[model samples]
Each structure stands twice: as C-alpha cells, then as structure tokens.
Target: MELNRFYCGDAIKIMQTFSDNAIHLICADPPYNLGKDYGNTIDRKEWSAYETFTRDWLTQAIRVLRNDGTLYVFMGVRFIARLYAILENDFGLLFNGWITWHYTQGMGRIKGYSPRHEDVLYFTKSKDFTFNLDDIRIPQKYYRERNNMDGANPGDVWQFSHVHYSSKEREEHPTQKPEAVLERMIRASSNPGDIVLDPFVGSGTTCKVARDLGRRWIGIDVNPDYIAMSERRMAQTATLFDSFDPRLKRTPLDLPR
Candidate 1:
C-alpha cells in the first residue's frame, strides 16, 4: 500500500488490494450515469448495472475506511436519493450530512428549471469521526461578545463556482471540481499526515488538495489520460486555491470595543 501514488486501473479492483481500515478519509466524484464521454469509458449504464457498480465500489470503500474515517460522495440529483439509501440502509454507514453544492452558472434547460446544484452525501464509518471545525469555519457575519469569532460552521449548502473552462487551473476533464471544495473536505475531516483516498479521481482535485495540505493520498482512475492530467497538475507549484466560499471575505458588522 504505497501512499501519495496514483493507480491507473479500475477503482473497485484497486481498492480491494488495500488492507481493511486503512483509509482516514475519502472524497469520491464518480460518474453520474449521464452518458458523458470519459475518453476510454462511457458514463452510461443500465439502471441495474449502475446500481451493482455503485454497491460493489462502496463495499470496497467502506472496508478500506478506518473506523473513524469519513466519506463524501458527489452525485447528481437523478440518483442521489438512491445513493443515500444504499449508504445508510444497505451499507450501514452513519449519515452525517446532505450537502448541496450550489454553483452560479450552468447549462440552461427550457423544459424545466435549470439544474443549479449537485448533492454531496457525507457519511462516516462510525459515530466518532474527525471533523476540525476550526479549520473549515467561515467568518462571522456580525461582531458580538457571544460569537466564537473564530468563524461559523459552513453549513450544508456550499457555494463554489465550477472551475471554468477558460481558467488556467481548469483541466480537460468534463467534471473537474474547484480546488476549494476538496480543500474544505480535507481540512475538516482529516488532520495532517492522515491518509486520504479518492477512488474516482477524475481530474484529481482531491489528491492535489490533500498533498497541498500535508496529507498522504491515493488516487485511482481508469483512464491513463486522466492519470497524466493529475500528474501534470501535481507537478505544478502550489498557488492560492482557484475558488472559495464568498463568506470568507465578508466583514463583521459593528465591531465591539
């Protein structure tokens, strides 16, 4: 079990090689079964086949997770409810939160309201899990003697713009996520030197952020091209994150003397 390495292979098979209770945190953004082109693979699968795939990978993911480990999975609306049930009822993972990632821009739909958000299901292997509130808190909205002043819990609804195609940090991957989103997860759920794993690494935002934050990481992706893309990004010098919570910049009103 090598740390800080990218394995270009099937996620389930790759995870099966890991020892049980080995991973401290996992941030996964698997395909949404929306028929997207992912170079060597297609995101489309029969409903039954997709469910089987989901269960298979999750079984391995849960096995590899430490007792105190946390998992955050990104999903589109179509299958989010099903995913939640599978995590809680079938796998017996403890539900921590249902996070809605609200983005300001997206493709328009004339037939219905445009989709503006994606869901991230947060779960833990057990009741006791790592969550560094101070590391992930947002600034207070108003000054008060009672306020913790350190910051406030970011809550379940997160606002981060998609990594725009024209941005220098953007990769060729179809669903590349903003670095700040992964940063928040890594910062909150795991401490420095803990092992972070991303089974469906995509463009590798999870691995990149984990490395930047001093954590050991493993990234698994089926596509060799994406492995190369991740490697390229990892080789670059670290910079300020591409996006962040707007609340981080807000000034508290009426400072107390």
Candidate 2:
C-alpha cells in the first residue's frame, strides 16, 4: 500500500497496512498510561489489556521492520518494570538499551528530587542496526578538557533537558517532546532520506523535525488537531522537505509563551 506523507487515523490499524522491511525506524511516543487526557485518550486499560495492547503493536511493528531497522519507544520512568517484562517475555534477544533521557525538570512537591528523565527503549530487529554515535554528540561544555575522546559520549544518560519553561516550543499538549530531542534521535539513528515513521505524532513535532532534516517521514496522529498543527508547522518551515539541510540555521520553533 502506498502510504501518504501523513495519516490521521488509528495507528494500529494504519500500521497493519504498511509493508514489511519498508520503514527504517519506528520512533513511537505512545500513551504513557498516566490516566490523563491525551488528544483522544483511550479509556484507561486494565493490566492484562495493557499487555495485550503492547503485544499487538510489537507483533505488527516487528513484522514491518527490516532486519537492520530499529524501534525506539519512549515511555515514563515508572513504566520500566512492566514494559521490560513485556519485552523480555515477548521479544527476547531483540532488546538493546534502556537508554535514559536525563532531563532537568519534573520534580513535584513530594519527597524525592522529582522525576524528570524518561526511558528510550531501543530494540533492533537484528544485530546489524543503524547507530552512528559520532553524528549525535552534543557539544562538550569543556571542549578543552577532552583531548582525544570523541566529544562527550554520555552513553544513555542523555544530559539534554526538556525544552525550557520559557522555551517557545511548548505546545498545548502536555506530553509534547522538544524538537531538539527528536533532532538528536533522527540524526544519530537514520541518514538523510531514510524513512522515519512516527506512529503517535502529537503536534507533528517528529514529522516537522524529520522534514526539516531531509528525511522522508510518515506521521500518523489520532487527532485532527495534531495533524493540523503539524501541517501548519511544515508550512512554517520555508524549505521544501526535499531540500532541507541539517546545517541550516536552526529556526527556533515557535511555541506558546
């Protein structure tokens, strides 16, 4: 089936139509089971049903991925245990890293130092997968100190924080991830013109970043609002996606202030 640039529909059903080995990467930001209002949040699910849901998507995603393709799933820190069980029991050796995106926010009024980071679970279909570490390195705060080491390869503790509170990228959606974060993943994981799939494309941030970086992207969102927001964001981006370059001056994405 010839999928268009973006689709506004149920992600599971839409994913079923895609061909095997077609997509290079599946970067999913599915519901976190936080029991809150996502654009069109599913009525909260029971534990068994939640596992079933994960299994269903994993089955379909694995089928569509090439041997070299990778699946990167972002979830809350609290979800690690259950999700890890699901990955181990169901997917076996395919599990890769329990990469932590260490951000600098999320502390509540309670006891501990707040929960700011997230888990970006990496699962490759096979041993041979695309992972170019050199391309995604953040500039060393102390470039002079590190003489030979290839920039600060922070390994999973991604030190970059979420978009700042005064950041312009903040959207109405509570769960919107920053574009800088997506930029790192898209760059380090896939090459230019690679097929990047974002199944839960809230506010189309992933698609926008993909487009701005010259990747061929397919974004599916359950909400029309998100789809519209993504399209507007694309239009806001001046260059045609085909001509985009990573070296272009990063136009700070506008957001609610």
Candidate 3:
C-alpha cells in the first residue's frame, strides 16, 4: 500500500499487477472521447475500445481497493452516461455525490450555453465510506463577525480557478485538469500517507497533489509523453523519484524526463 508508482504503458495491463483490497483511493480522468489523435491511432477514441479499456482496469482497481475506500472519476459531460453505466453495473458501487466544477472557458459555442463545467462522480465500493469534510472546506464570501462556523462547506457545485490555455501551468496535455481542482479532492478525502491511485494520470496533476500532501501514489497512462511529464512534475515538486522500495521499478524512467 506504500508506494510511489507510475506506470507508462496500457492502464489495464499495469493495474493487474497489484493485489486485492490494497488501495485507499482512486481518482481517474480517462480519455474524454474527445476524438483527438494519439499520434499512432486514427480511430476516434473509440468508445467500445475505451469501454473495454475501462472495464479491464476497473476490474483490477475494484479488487485492489479497500472495502471502505473511495473511487472518484471526472468525466466530460458528453460521456458521463456511458462512463456511469460502466461503473454502476460492474462495481456495484454506491453513488456518494456528484461534484460540479466550473471552468471559466471551454469548447462549446454560443448556440448552447457554452459548456463550462465537468462532473466528478464520487462512489464507494460499499455503503461505508470515508469523508473528511474539514480537509476541503472553502471560505464564505462575506465575513461574519461572530459566526462560530469554521469555514463554508463546499457546495456540490464548486467554482474553482481554472488553468487557462495560456497559463504557465499548462503542459503538453491538452485536457489537463487544474491543480487546484485536484488539490481540493485530495484534501477532502485523504490523509497524509494514504495511497491515492490515478489510472489516467495525464500530466500528473493528481500525483503532484498527492505527493505534496504526503500521500503515497500510483498513476498509469498509455502515453509515454504523459509518463515522462508526470515524472518531471514529481521531480519539480522535489518528491523523491525513488520507488517505495529499491527493487520496485516504475514504468517511465527509460523515457526522457
């Protein structure tokens, strides 16, 4: 359960190597069916192929997750139904909450309210789940002089700052989630030293937050570019690249960082 892991190849193949009931959390943002080319493939991020890919990894992920653990997934609004169907029937996971995040800019046109939000679904393997509310509370808009309340509990609809296309944090990954967004999720659900697994690591923002918070982490993505970017981000944070053990080798070191 204690490991600093990053796998560079297919998520499904890499996830299989882990044992059952071992992980505390999983936060994944797989391909959004955006139809973008992966350099080698020409098919339109095929849903059938993606579905099978998800099923393969989810099977392993479910087995590796602890009973009271949590699974969080961020999905494009367009693909939520398909993704939810996959999770609901396969895992028997109970729906905990649907978190809505507002992004300042997006791809939609003026015709239909430009899509500016993404959905984050939180589900638990069983009815029993862990929630540390205090870890992610945001402040109230107006200051109250004598209010005994600590901070405003974040509403289901969260308005977080976004990483715009021109920002310095922008990496090679086109669909990278803002780091603040991942920060809140990690804070709300996990503690220092907890294991957080991210199956679609992309530019590794989730892993970066997990490491910054002193959590153990594992991330897997099919792209070598993503894996290398993840390692660099990890390195930039000064998170030691040493695997949890000397003998444990992560999958992306061979690629240039």
Clashes of 1: 0
Best prediction by TM-score: 1
lDDT of 1 by residue, 148-228 (tens): 889889999999999999998999999999999999999999999999999999888999999999999999999999999
lDDT of 2 by residue, 118-175 (tens): 8888888788888878876543434353342354444666655565556565666767
Native-vs-model 1 lDDT?
Answer: 0.95
lDDT of 3 by residue, 103-155 (tens): 66567786777787899988888877667777755544445565424555676
Ranked candidates (TM-score, high to low): 1, 3, 2
lDDT values, one for every candidate: 0.95, 0.73, 0.75
Candidate 2 residue pairs in backbone clash: none
Which one wins by lDDT: 2 or 3?
3
The reply for model 2, stretches above 4 Å from the true place, is 1-4, 111-113, 139-150, 164-166, 238-257
**Winner by TM-score between candidate 3 and candidate 2:** 3
lDDT of 2: 0.73
